[model samples]
Target: MSAAFEIFLQGTPGLEEALAEEARATGFAKAEAVPGGATLQGQWTTVWRANLKLRGAGAVLARIGGFPASHLSQLDKRSRAFPWGDVLRPGVPVKVEMSTSAKSKIYHAGAAQERIERALSESFGATIDPEATVVLKTRIQRDYVQFSVDTSGESLHKRGHKPAVGKAPMRETLAALFLRQAGFTGEEPVLDPMCGSGTFLIEAGEMAAGLWPGRDRRFAFEDLATFKPDLYARIRSEAPQPRPLEELPGLFGSDRNAGAIEMAGRNAEAAGLGGAVTLAHRAVSDLERPAGPPGLVIVNPPYGARIGDRKQLFSLYGRLGAVLKERFGGWRAAIVTSDGGLARATGLPILPPGPPVAHGGLTVKLYQTAALR
Candidate 1:
């Protein structure tokens, strides 16, 4: 068993605490929200579980070892002495990346990367690849350097299931966090009226079914030397079967574009949620409250879109508010948009927007509304 180490869960700027809540809910040990991300101490298996169970983490890093080095030669010596065999393999290709602050003695990132590369090459017999599956990251702040391994090969948002995507697609990680922010657990139904590519519906459906987001993806940890095949096999095999679609609450989505509706279905099928989610082509004004009970309405609409005329969206927001007020009574709504003016245009009594989130070069905020009358 690998020793317990600090595992960092990278989250979106404004949504770090939400990811920490998810980590705590998923039973990660010592999960705490940090400035840029979340951190927890865990063994190797915990790393695997974080990749599998954490829906809100953008990336996961495993803290290796590092030392204080004032110069390149000292860095090389210390890095070579570091036990690369403990976590990383000898032959596995790696990419060394470093970020040095102005307060650090090693001011040149390139020079620091070169020293780390040489250490890996001489001691670990590892080849450096620009596009390697394993990433070795170094963070130098005020002469203190911490080395970490990117345990998530790609961003956690790239679940490797959805090939078809719509314009301004909401990342799966963001969608999951946003769902949590809206107070929707697996028990409640969810609807995304402007469900381009069905991100919200699919994420909700997976949550309701107890599906693992990382089940379909390969993690970088699989390439490490510390990986135990039998232990990992047991872990992977322990994946719980998803609840039958009929047993869960409704997870619905709709879009005006027929193409988006079709693509959404394909994405759902790829995610093993074809039966769990129901996406259709319909405008917001045509949305009907799903029968049985009121749930949550979550939508990510275009606010400062470049392709569409911005003026046309006001009428669209107005119609969305009108439909929800008249038909979707007793349901809560969460809207994400870059423009507060457009959010207010919805005419729903949405609460004041929260901390601005950096998304696609724009700062967006979530506007939450109480249950409609």
Candidate 2:
């Protein structure tokens, strides 16, 4: 084993446990949930699996090395002593992010950063850039420091497929995690009544088809000198491709904004899922169940934070409830919103609700209502 690894998952406040639960189910043994992250033990294969499978994880990191540092000089010396050649190449540009805790005497972050940067550059000629192809973060909490490299270059949520988006759009990773929470499999018809940019719908299609989330992109670690490219290639070659579109369930989505729907269609097509994703210009009020007896209906409507009014959202929720109860009674529904009061206004008798998940600095709840009468 190289070392005990840490996998960092980022999302709205309430979704940590949900994301942790999913990570555990996906062979990440001994998974422990923390605020904004989950640390688990696994090898490089686990790291690779995480980037490919995790829907809620915003970033996956591999712990390169670290040691305790009482002062700035100790921090610099310990950092320089790390085997940079083991993980980083000489030519690749890198970025450094540092955070200090109360126990550390290194009050000046810039000074601390400069020391580490100088150490790396002088020792290995490693370049640092914020927009670089690779990023390494040094976090000093209390007197201990942890050095980690971001294996997932962009946030895993990017998925590199969505070129266009709408206001207040839901992230692909969050949508995947929510779908799992709502018991969504790719085998059932899914309707996103207020689908913005079709993230949920596209993710649903990918999930049902067993499509690897990282299939369309390259990882930052691939460029590292010590990275086992052969091992990674073997892992990728052996991964099970999505069963077949015919065997998976169809996906459906709609939005009041025709532009969002158009963008969603284009994004889905770009992801090679145009045939699997069905998007249309439709309002939540007009949502209805097709011939399917019961499927999953997920809506991420505006929570009065941005385009919609807060008081007005109550009416919208009420109308949405009416539509769900009358038109899609048997289907399972999941609604994501920042407003708890507006969620209750839907009058759907949802359960106690899960913990708050963080989304763009806001605490959003994944509200679910099932067993509709």
Candidate 3:
């Protein structure tokens, strides 16, 4: 339908720069970071490719249209006049959500939402549903009404293949970006000594084996009127064949809990990545570097707010640091923690902190290390 439009790739708060870099590296055109997300300038096909290829984006929004609304009456009139058939088909259900700024005359978000819904229903014969999979996001800022369609139904972190998870599993999108920040390039081994559900290990293995992150999922864009199913299939089919397990370097993980290790194994197997991602049940104290070229060791251990008590975690962090310092030479390390004191307890010469990333309401920072002395 439309030739070209602005594509918004939503990212975590502090990781917008990482998402922008990922967008550019993945061949997106004119990719740049914005406050809440990254923008890519491209056609309809590019939107589809972004949904399928970009690993760091939480959701992709195709900004369809916008207009300056002097008032509610003008907003309704202009919304009806817009060509809704180009993107939204008749009988397709859409849920409208609107946000208004303090400077706008039409200050009620509910009023704007209802007006747009009525226009889509009465004028375009489209169904309006509060529980629809297709979400129409609208923003009213400084009296300007901007509209965008949520091309991604669920967050990209789902990945569609991991049915099992340990407590507080790290999202795949965040894990991918964190791996990049740790300087991983699929050429080195990755070890998650305190791995829970084995997110970091599996994601690293998938990247190394050339597996596409979105192969197992369906996107909301497929339901759009402008969606070209055949073209989308072609884009998905362009992904490379996964490398054999033996050819991939070690992507290893181990947990103290047997149940966690089992669940992580099952999740990796479901993702068709069991061969490249190896999981075992063990404690952080017993962690030994895999026998090969040195690589990056990244882990997300429990913090004070969840899983373990604050006073008792100091020894756990201390043990993890001591083991790494004693056993792993020529290997780099990265630790993520919401508490700076916990990070310091690692005693591994933590590098300068990266920006604080929001993780489940807690702000966590990634502290990395150079090759061990």
TM-score for all models, in order of appearance:
0.97, 0.94, 0.98
lDDT of each: 0.89, 0.80, 0.89
* Backbone collisions counted per model: 0, 13, 0
TM-score winner between candidates 1 and 3: 3
lDDT of 3 by residue, 185-250 (tens): 888999999888888988898888878788899989888998888888788889888888898889
Worst 10 residues of 3 by lDDT: 271-280
C-alpha lDDT (0 to 100) for residue 248 of candidate 3:
86
lDDT tens readout by residue for model 1, 215-254: 8889999999878889988988988888998998998899
Candidate 1: C-alpha lDDT: 0.89
Taking the tens digit of each residue's C-alpha lDDT, what string does model 2 give over 1-373? 3665555655445677777887888777677778777878777677887887777788888877788888888978877788898778888998998878877777677888898898888877888777887888888887888888888888888887778888887788888888988888666788888887889988888888777788878888787774787788887886686666666576888888899899989998877788877777878778757765578888888887755679878888898888888988678778888888888998897877767777766778888987577
Which ten-residue region of model 1 has the weakest summed lDDT? 301-310
| Model 3 ranges off by over 4 Å | none
Q: TM-score of the candidate numbered 3?
A: 0.98
